[model samples]
Target: MKAFVFPGQGSQFVGMGKDLYETSPLAKELFDKADAILGFKITEIMFAGTDEQLKETKVTQPAVFLHSVISALCMGEAFEPSMVAGHSLGEFSALVASGALSFEDGLRLVAARANAMQKACEANPGTMAAIIGLSDEHVEEICKEVSVGGKVVIPANYNCPGQLVISGDVEAVDAACEKLKEAGAKRALPLKVGGAFHSPLMQPAQEELQEAIEKTGFNTPKCPVYQNVDAKPHTDPTEIKQNLIAQLTSSVRWTASVQHMIADGADDFTECGPGKALQGMIGRIDRNVALHGIA
Candidate 1:
């Protein structure tokens, strides 16, 4: 079976999706629609903007989503997937690709999510760090140990074997990194991010985005979407919505999600997004599967 995946925030770059926009009429139309719907010339920013401009949360989220979903859509008959999954913001892309959400609705939701997350970051400052060459249990235990007295940190993204990302308050995250390094982790590198995503600090963003999500309609997707919250495949609309609502504050179980897809007979994996991060993670997760990229 074929499993199509989408990448998250850090996958974006300058001139992303410009090639498709110029080469495919459908992609151009969609890009135009995105610009109008976003109330800005997002296409110009995506096509010719500088790195700093594209790094804005609002632009990065939507730009990556557009590149990912449009790439899959432009594939026409070749974009078939028995199952799909995405990392963080890319979940919206996967939802749109699998027919669970309309293109316009997906874009609107991504915009809303980006704004909400940005506000949450401003309201409560925090950050994330990457812990490499450590067991997940060791990192989790260290996070739990350091998180105390209103300082919250947790294992956020389980990227692949021996690699995990943790998110939380700045002080708590710093303390956790110290402990993780002392616990024999090969490297504990802090990520350059505005806030702690997929952690308790995003509770405000979760609450705010929930209203928008509940109000939006979701159709049953063409294929099951392995969600990030629990790394489980969901096909029901209500369940999918609920998972999405919870996703902002839950861990992104990417490693488990890929494992489940392979266990379920997904030997072919295609990453539909701007960067090759997901492909690299999937390759580390299991080297036997064939991997491809569309970006």
Candidate 2:
């Protein structure tokens, strides 16, 4: 069976979907629709914006979603999958691709999510860091030791073997990074993010997004979507909605999700997004599985 995966943030670039926009009429039509729905020329920013401009949470989220979903649409009859999964914000794109959500609805959700997250960030300053060459347990222990007196920190993204991202208050994250390095991590590099995602700091964002999510309509998906919150495949609309609502404060179990997919008979994995980060992570998770990329 084949599994289609979508990448989240940090997968975007300046000229992400320009080629597709210029080449395919279908892609252009979708891009135009996105611009109208977003109330601005997002296509202009996506095609010619600077790195800093595209890095804004609002632009980054929907820009990546558009590139991924439109790329899948451009695949036409070839874009078939036994199952689908996405990392963080990419979940919206996966839902649309799997027929669980309409394209316009997905874009609107992404935009709302991004704006809410940004607001949460501005309200409470925080950050994230990447820990390489450390066991997940070891990193978790370090985070626990460093987090105290409301300085909340926790493991955020389990990217692959020996690679995990931690998120929390800026001081707590920095202290955790130091301890993780002392615990024999190869590198504890801080990420360029505005706030601590997938941690308690995002509770405000979660609360804000919950209303939008509940208001949006979700149809039965064509295939099961392995959600980010629990790394479990969910087909029911209610279950999907619940998982999505909880995902803002839950660790993204990418490694476990890929393992579950492989165990469930996903032999061929195709990454549908701007960057090849998911492909690389899946490769490291299981070398025996075949890998392909759409963008």
Candidate 3:
């Protein structure tokens, strides 16, 4: 069996969709439709604008979605997945690729989600950090101890065996990083992210997104999707909705998701997104795992 995975943020770059836009008529029509739907020529920013322009949360989320989904669309009948999963924002793309959401609806929902998250970030200032070479339990305990007085610091991304990302308020994250390093973490480094995603800080964003998610239509998927919140394959639409809601505030169990896929007979894991980040993480989680990229 083959599993198709999609990357989240931090995979996008300038000139991301230039090749598709210039070569494939299907890609061109979709890009043009996206520009009309978004009410702006995002293609301009994606193809020619500066990194600063592409980095806006509102733009980055939808832009990455477009790149991944359009690439998958252009794959014609060659793209098939026994199981599907995505990291963070990539879940929306995965849902579309798996036939759970229509392309138009997916793009609209991604735009709404991005705007909501950005607004939440502006309302509450926070950040995230990467802690390398620390056990998951050790990192969780340290974060819990450091997040005293209603401040925030929690494990956000379980990327691979010894690599975890923490998210919370600026001060809490900094303190946790210091303590993690003191506790023998190889490196406790702050990420260049704008806010603390997948933490309590995103509660406001979750509340805002709830309405849109409920309003959007969901259908039976073409294949089971291993959702981020639970790291399990789900076929029911209700379960998918609940998981997506929880995903905004829960840690991404990517390591566990990959393990589940492998256990279920997945042989080829193809990453359908911009970067090879997922491939690298999957490789580290299980050296026997094979990976392919669709970039």
lDDT of 1 by residue, 246-289 (tens): 99999999999999999999999999989899999999999999
lDDT of 3 by residue, 179-285 (tens): 99999999999999989999999999999998899998898999999999989999899999888888888999999999999999897898997899999999998
Question: What is the C-alpha lDDT profile of model 2 across 144-216, one tens digit per residue?
Answer: 9998998989999999999999999999999998888888999999998999999999999999999999999
- True-structure lDDT of candidate 2: 0.95
Candidate 1, which ten residues in sequence have the lowest lDDT sum? 10-19
Residue 179 lDDT (model 2): 89
For model 2, name the residue pairs that clash: none
- Sorted by lDDT, highest first, which candidate order results? 1, 2, 3
Candidate 2, position 135, lDDT: 91
Off by over 4 Å in 2: none
The TM-score values for the models, in the order shown, are 0.99, 0.99, 0.99
Clashing pairs in 1: none
